[model samples]
Target: MPTPGFPPSTLDSEGTPIWISDLAGGDPNHVLHVVRGIEAEDALEALGAKPGLIRSCELPDSKPDEWTSLPCAALGVEPGGSAALLAGRVGEWTFVYDDSGFTYDDAVTKALSADGRTAATSVYTINGDASLTYAVDGEQVEWVNFDDLELDEGFAGMPAELRAAFEAAGNVETEDFEPGEADGDILMRAACALAGLALTLDDVRRVPLLVVPFG
Candidate 1:
């Protein structure tokens, strides 16, 4: 059965599953959008992808790393473009696996939420740093880095329910804590929990997907 607020296989009132942050689990870099009320093409445009470059394809296996090297031709990747992005819909929202794109661009997050859609973005860079953001209707509500764990807005615009639930499952801060795998796990759960997403492993692995240029 589904947890009260979180997805069936996601977090609970107690905590997140141990599997959320592993290489065998969620994509390392992603921006999950609550696009239920919008169309797929519109959602892509909102993320600032080039309109004519979108391609259709299917994932061959369940590897999370495949997102980085989706068939070049099948993904419609241009000769001189930034990294390619893969997108797939899971229920009402669209899950986008981004590679070296706009995960940190405040503008992209603003545009995505401008149309009343919510966005949850998270990333753990190889340099031992991590970032997470939650936006609603063009307003950035949550912005924090694993290095500091200091929320820029202090849960200002989050709904009462999400705020409390996130506070519970999200990790607590330590004085000299540098981010590690555990921090990455927190990001995976936050990307979904903060945006009210309910993603399961089966939803992304080997799913039919849309590929677009990062720019």
Candidate 2:
């Protein structure tokens, strides 16, 4: 109906909506990685997380702002040198949400996509810029940025349909967001839509994951 994943998702509990806009409105800094065909533990290990510190937990039943310190402290992590992230398999995609921007690297995004996994990364910066990078089987296909608003470069291998979706995801307009409040979610939506992941806020809330102190 809605092009499979475009438009700000909304649900009584999931989809894109004020929840995402609110996340950006409050912190505007985080990294969300969606990797297709990988388990939660494999996703963490792929990202260089130590196996010992990895702990099983449910997504915090709290707001995102409190996540930075609370989870890391509980995991005995300093919450400074490395980021405490939540990773889990939800359907065909493994979602990793980094409250701290520690995993916000293009190399890391491509690395996850390596060895037969398809991955997409959405990076939201405190300076109000955001980006979505799409990769396949370990190679970077393309990347688009909110600040520059450019879709050119690294798109040669990407299909026309996906490229068009990226265009659509970036150009989404809604009064739901105040100034600069939707960039992160927009990129996130683009990533999910492009990668064919159906996500809900309830899944984010209810999924079982291995929490890790990731550098």
Candidate 3:
């Protein structure tokens, strides 16, 4: 059996391979938050990497023809949906046809790299059916994808608050930030924002966004 921190998850019962990213929910010590697929190979390839990709089969089919709403419900960003929603808005991404053929380092590097403007970090597993159990007890780790967050101008300067939340979370400025590339700093900040809401490590599993509840 593969332990935590391993890469490239095995195929589910439906023959679909599960891709997990360490969204880590709120607990810095914890790992793995959301599990989804690597949608949009062109998005990945545009990021610069070998072909072969996976995408989430659970995405909203019809497109809403309007975007003039205050909090656009179309913002429809499922924590466990396909990366296509986020990656499609940004850049290209390719899928991996064979897991054994590629090394974990290579796959991770490709996902983490900013070559194609944006790419997924990698995949992991969520463990048992006791989903909440993962974040409870002594050891808690939730797997989440970085691409799922609706991180645009709506979350530009949210770093200060995010940094205070997660010990492992911080900013990583780089000249590499392209015109349309998603900023990692903003992403990390948003992660923290979401963390503030989580009391126990388990409370933050398969999270949606850095939503801070109003007092």
Candidate 4:
């Protein structure tokens, strides 16, 4: 059985998984985007690569520009996997592929090359409507919305302890507390991770996901 409130895993009329590329092809307005998971290859295949990929690393112990910063989480990375793959739209959104057995610097370089852009270390994070929006066959998906998708998926892998934390947080309710007040768990978890706090799976589940904030 499926959860009643959550978005359904997309299916076709015949109950087949819909390939985003096929969906996007029929109506250019339907852009299928993925930020986390083993779905990047599929997303790229569907949308095709655009020019000028940018990448950056998140710095622990400091809050970088919110809209233009990476998650500086200590994801328990091991040797030979010191850096995360901070790829995607450079400043706007980054998908941290940690323990990827790759260097962050090198991964960023390759990503930039894929779009035929000369990689530069000290470039201004792309801004403006042009920078925030991505198109597939001319359909637009805003990066702001895309970040929510990534954050949600990221928590999907969080340990059970964190989930309990969330359940606990969700319990503290007051007549004065707005519906949005329930999201403190999501903020705490994501902020902890973004600030390089050691994360347990328990922590992951407890994090309040700020979905509507981005939307």
- Model 3: lDDT equals 0.25
The residue-by-residue lDDT of candidate 2 on 37-120, one tens digit each, is: 888888888778888878897543444454344445445555356677777776788877776777888889899999887888
RMSD versus native structure for model 1: 6.1
Candidate 3 Cα errors over 4 Å, as ranges: 1-41, 46-87, 90-106, 110-124, 128-215
Query: Residue 15 lDDT in model 1?
Result: 37
Ranking by TM-score: 2, 1, 3, 4
Report the C-alpha lDDT of model 1 over 19-63, residue by residue, as the tens digit: 232112224333334433555566676777788887776643433
What TM-score quantifies how close candidate 4 is to the native fold? 0.21
**Using lDDT as the measure, which candidate wins?**
2
The residue-by-residue lDDT of candidate 4 on 65-101, one tens digit each, is 2311122232223322222222222222222222121
Provide the global lDDT of candidate 1 against the true structure: 0.53
- Give every collision pair in model 1: none
lDDT of 1 at 146: 63
Candidate 2 vs candidate 4: which has greater lDDT? 2
Report lDDT (CA) for all predictions. 0.53, 0.64, 0.25, 0.24
TM per candidate comes to 0.64, 0.73, 0.21, 0.21
lDDT tens digits, residues 28-63, model 3?
Answer: 111112112233344334334334332333222332
Model 2 global lDDT (CA atoms, 0 to 1)? 0.64
